[model samples]
Target: MLGATSHIAGRVLPAVGRVPGNVVEAVASRPGRVAAAGEVARRFGARVHDGYDALLGDPEVDAVYVALPNSEHVTWALRALEAGKHVLVEKPMALSEQDCLRIGRAAGDLVVMEAYMYRFHPQQRKVVQLLGRGEEGCGEAEGRGEGEGGGIGELRVVRAAFAYPTPVEGNIRFDPALGGGATWDVGCYAFDVPLWAFGVEPCRVWARFHGDPVDLGAVAVLDFGDGRSAVLDYSLEYGPRAHYELQGTRGSISVRNAWTTPHEDGVITVVTLDGVREEVVPAADAYELQVAAFADAVRGRRESLVVPLDHSVRVARVGEALIRANAVGDWVDLTSR
Candidate 1:
């Protein structure tokens, strides 16, 4: 792994233990304050490299997991792919479509995947199934309904938020030059899930931002074709909380603690035209599922579930336009990019 010190690496490295044909061979990068990276490597009987090059140079390391900052994803990912190592990069694959395309081009015949762990959770799969069925109460009711008014309603308003208090001064997330911003951070997930669920590219986008140095918060509207739309909000100033709400004409479905550290038990509540139904989804180790899926892709056993490179690139394009729109206080047309 390239960024052994990140919060994600800490969770995912151990999860890779459960999947077969995988081993934590090395931890790379400059040492971190937590020392957890060293501890993790020691626990796994893996060697710790003082630098990323050492890990990449190792003849036995077959693949790399990149949990670096947003700005570095493209560079490190491309380097890893050029080194002939498969890559599983953290989300917001790059800050722009051009960078994503460059990284994708570099991957040629190797695996290069963006890491969106929740997509692998069983609850997420169930939600997809429920949406596909579009029938009330036929499945676990997290939230399912048809609006009393009539037209067959697909997902209408999607509300997603991810926030956590950050006191760490000089963290990468606060550095604008490093692509640190609420949009690049949590908003990527907010935009990605709905885009994937709706299975359509957005036709229009409007956004607003708050805070300085780095945007402390943002709200955006994505217009998918067919009158379907998504609304997203994100911040770093709020108390720890993450949730997603998908509303349809018949009813609405929501997941509580949709995204959180130490990933909590996911809850789905469905409201239908007839009544309200709720289901408590059991806690799952999503990190393990993410790692297992990555390993499966590495083994050529299956395709990846995270948004593909092209899709992620398009998402980044939308994000870039959102940033521009937020600055000018005008809706930005993204058709060209």
Candidate 2:
């Protein structure tokens, strides 16, 4: 694992322990963070490296999990690929679409994936099935007889909000240079749902922000043509609210605890003309599932990554459009660009 981030201990390291064929060969961080690295290594019974490059050179390690600041993602990911190590980097693969493409080009026959751990959860699997995708990546919608989506019919709009109180002081999210902002931080997750649901990129995008240098909060709209759209709002200064609602002709589905899933039991509520019902998804650690998937892909057991590089590129493109729209104060035409 790379970087001594807190979540690595709380989420990823434990996941490494639980998933079969996965182990923490070593933990590495920047200089002066040896104590932080030591804490993680001691707990998991792994070696500690003083810096990232040292960890990469270790022959015992096969894959590297990058949990560094967002700005540092592309550089290290590229370097790890060069070092002949499989990479599973965190989301917003890069700050720009061009950089995402760079990672894709460098990763030839090597397993490189964006770590959107929540996508591997069964709750999301249920959502995908409800939207008529057959048990895997967000490919073309399948024939479910009743129009398109199995339970929700033809999708019209997706409304999502993911927010929590992240203080301004010393918070990396508020740092402009570190690729810190509400849009890239939490909005990427929100954007994925709409993109996955529509199974296409938006024709037009518009947005507004609440902070300077970096966005503290943002509200945006994506136009997918044919009156289909996605409304999204994300913040780092608001009360906790993590959920999304998908509205369609036949019925609507509301997902609570959508992003930070497998923490507690997930709740998916579907409402249609027939009636209203709730599907309670048992809590399962998404990090472990993600680790297993990465292992499978590395061993050639899985054909592709759950969150492919192209999907990460798309997410970066949409994110860029939203930020540009906010800057220009108008809707940006994606097709023309």
Candidate 3:
């Protein structure tokens, strides 16, 4: 893994231990962070290095997990790809569409996946199934006829929100240069669900950002045209909350604990003309499932990736436009950008 000091790097190490044959053999950090990195190394039983470039040259390393700051995701991912190693970079893999596209060019033949573990959760798949799509499918596969909303009709909107209490001092989410902010950090996932659900890129978007280099929170609207839209709001300074509500003809589906819903089982409440029903999904280890999918791609067993680089590029485009909207305080034209 790259950057042992990242919080996400620490969060997933235990999940890595749960997956068989996916050993984390080495971790690297800056020279000043060696002590902390070494602590992680000792706890995880992996070798430690202050120089990331040196870790790339380790013959024992089969693949790399990049949990570095958002800005460095593409850089290290490309380097790992050039070194002939598969890579699983964290979400918002690249800060902008241009950089995301660059990473696409460098990811020739080697397995490169963005680590958005939520996409692997069974509840997300269940949401698709409820919308008349194949249960076992990719992130953005098209859905069939809209199922009756029960009481609501025609699926017209998807509302998603992801927020957390204020970040502590020194947290990377507050740094603009490091790809910090509410939109890049949590809003990306907010956009991901709607894009994946609608199966088409938003044709127009407008947003506003507040705070420092990045944003403390953002409220945006993504119009997919033809009466379809996604309204999303995300913040870094709020009580902990993550949820999404899908509205369609006949009824609406409300998923409590949507984005952060773990694999230990979760609920999806469907309110339709028929009645309100809460379906219980089986327990899942989202991170483990993501790792398994990455491993399958590396082993040539999977045909398509869940969070393809193209998806990253499109999302980055939307995010950049959002920032632009904030700068100009007007609705920016996405196609023009």
Top candidate when judged by lDDT against the true structure: 2
- Residue 216 lDDT, candidate 3, scale 0-100: 91
**Model 2 bad stretches (over 4 Å):** 137-149, 260-263
For candidate 2, write residues 1-337 as lDDT tens digits.
Answer: 8885556446888888888778888999797798988988988999999989999999999999888889999999999999999999988789999999999999998899888877787788877777766667433333321344447778889899988888788877889999999999888988887887776888999999998878989999999988789999999988588789889888998988865545688889999888999988889888888888889999996554777777788899999999999999999999986
Against the true structure, what is each candidate's TM-score?
0.89, 0.95, 0.93
When summed lDDT is taken over every stretch of 10 residues in candidate 2, the lowest stretch is 138-147
Ranking by TM-score: 2, 3, 1
Clashes of each: 11, 0, 19
In angstroms, give how far residue 290 of model 1 lies from its true place: 0.4
Q: Candidate 3: give its CA RMSD in angstroms.
A: 2.1
The whole-model lDDT of each prediction reads 0.75, 0.84, 0.80
Predicted structure 3, TM vs. truth: 0.93
Least accurate 10 contiguous residues by lDDT in model 3: 143-152
Residue-level lDDT of model 1, residues 1-337, one tens digit each, is 8888788787888887777878889888764422655776888888888777777888889989999888888888888988899999998899887888888888887888788877777667656555764332111222223333222255677777777787657688888888897889877877876666565567778899998888988988887656677888878778576788878877777777766334466677878777777666667787787888777777885455444666777778888878988888987776655
TM-score of 2: 0.95
By TM-score, the best candidate is 2
Candidate 3 residues 1-337, lDDT tens each? Answer: 8978788886677778777777879999876788889999998899998889989999999889998888888889989989988889998888788988888788787778888888787887777777766656547746422554234556689899988887468888888788788888888888887877777777778887778666899888988877888999999998477888888866787778765535357688999777888988887777777887887788887554778777778888888888888788887777664
